[model samples]
Target: MKLENRRIWITGAASGIGEAMARQLSGVASLLIISDLNAERLLALKPELEKGITTVDALPFDLSNRTEVEKAADKVLATYGGVDLLINNGGISQRGLFYETTEEVDRRIMEINFFSYVVLTKKMLPPMLAQGFGHIAATSSMTGKFGFPLRSSYAASKHAVQGYFETVGLELYDRGIRVTVASPGRIRTNISVNALSGEGTRYGQMDPGQAGGMPAEKCAARYLRAIRRDQWEVYIGYNEILMIWFKRYLPWLFRKLALRVGKV
Candidate 1:
């Protein structure tokens, strides 16, 4: 819908695509409750965005922290009266062989990428349903559509979101809860550096594919348009968009092509 006067809550708002989205949407959104684990970086956005918007606030909390996330929901409700839209965009990634990956690595990925979204969504549903109107959009990944090398756990989490949200969207359709799952391909973000390594530390490096991916600002614009239109799903990328169709109608071909892409 029109973001003008819309009260939107976006997670992972400290950096990357989330940060870009907050900056671009500040002009249109009435109350932007920007949230992330890094309060300093969230404040860094103020200089870039504060000139045009009066209703910007930085909410620092770890989504992986269940109690903190729930408290954030309560804080949002108390502040804006209600959240018109909940953007479950906070998440992390993983890389390396599944066997080589530690249990903690996998758990952390699921905790941040999957469990956090579910918990936050559950908390927001009551308020949204009470209002009889709300939009929930998530930043899933192209990995959600297909499996890739060195991303078994990360892919699983994203796939879970696609399945859960798609079913919930239909189940809650009559309730006026719109759920849109955004699947973006390699975007120019610090995801690789921020991704969990097999040893549970930050991956600390950027992959060639991600380093040469789409700009975060442009990706944010594309995603925001999809949210405006209330699309069920939106895939962002140059050639990566084709992967969705490949996975849909030609699974074998997609797999064969993926083998050549060198890790996706």
Candidate 2:
């Protein structure tokens, strides 16, 4: 479970939390293969990451494309022999009310957030199973655990991630593959702008709530610790960390408070 000198593949490495993780893990990993839709950003990061770690490569492709993911998975296996860790972090977000959100918007969220993860995991599982050792880490959200208003589709997609991976973790536990799900509260990332709007369009704006959230590097460090320890789940945030407890023990109060805070 130690990250040092490990062979790792991280998606969504062009920016935000993924970018931070790539930077932090760069010094720790022996070979790092990063991917994202932003070719330019990925290229830009190469030099910086190389300064931290000698071996850093970036693969740019739309993860929503199953063909692209399959090809990428093949390349990773062929080149690396096998991946020690597969971080399924590439995903989009949801915005606006469910009723107001277009069907296309819902579909888009499901595609990037759920289907992409499923397909990528499916393609990688065989290699991991064959190797008999691998780590699978995903970036879920607090909303994944507790539903919120104006974000039904987003919440649902993340919930699906948790459900699918949690089951997969148990099924693969005896086989030596480890799965860790992260339910992070609001963090300083570009998720708002990347989120699909009500009309199935990009929001093209950042929310203040996200802007004021925890630093990306700090979150990345914590995630590294979780992976090193092979923790099953880790919740990240300030005061909002308590939401996990409330959601677990006081469902009625949690629902009421969540309703007052937003919608449920």
The numbered model that scores best in lDDT is 1
Model 1 regions more than 4 Å off: none
Task: Give per-residue CA lDDT, model 2, range 1-264, as digits (tens).
Answer: 988888888999999889999999878898889899999999999888885554888888887787887888888878877678888898888778889998888887887788888877877788788988889998888989988887888999999989998998999999999999988888899998888888977888887778888988888888878988999988987777777789999888888888887743
Q: Mind giving the per-residue lDDT tens digits that candidate 1 earns over 172-220?
A: 9999989899999999999999988778878889988889999999999
Mark the regions of model 2 whose C-alpha exceeds 4 Å error after superposition.
none
Cα distance off (Å), candidate 1, residue 226: 0.5
Q: For model 1, state the Cα shift of residue 59 in Å.
A: 0.6
The collision pairs in model 1 are: none
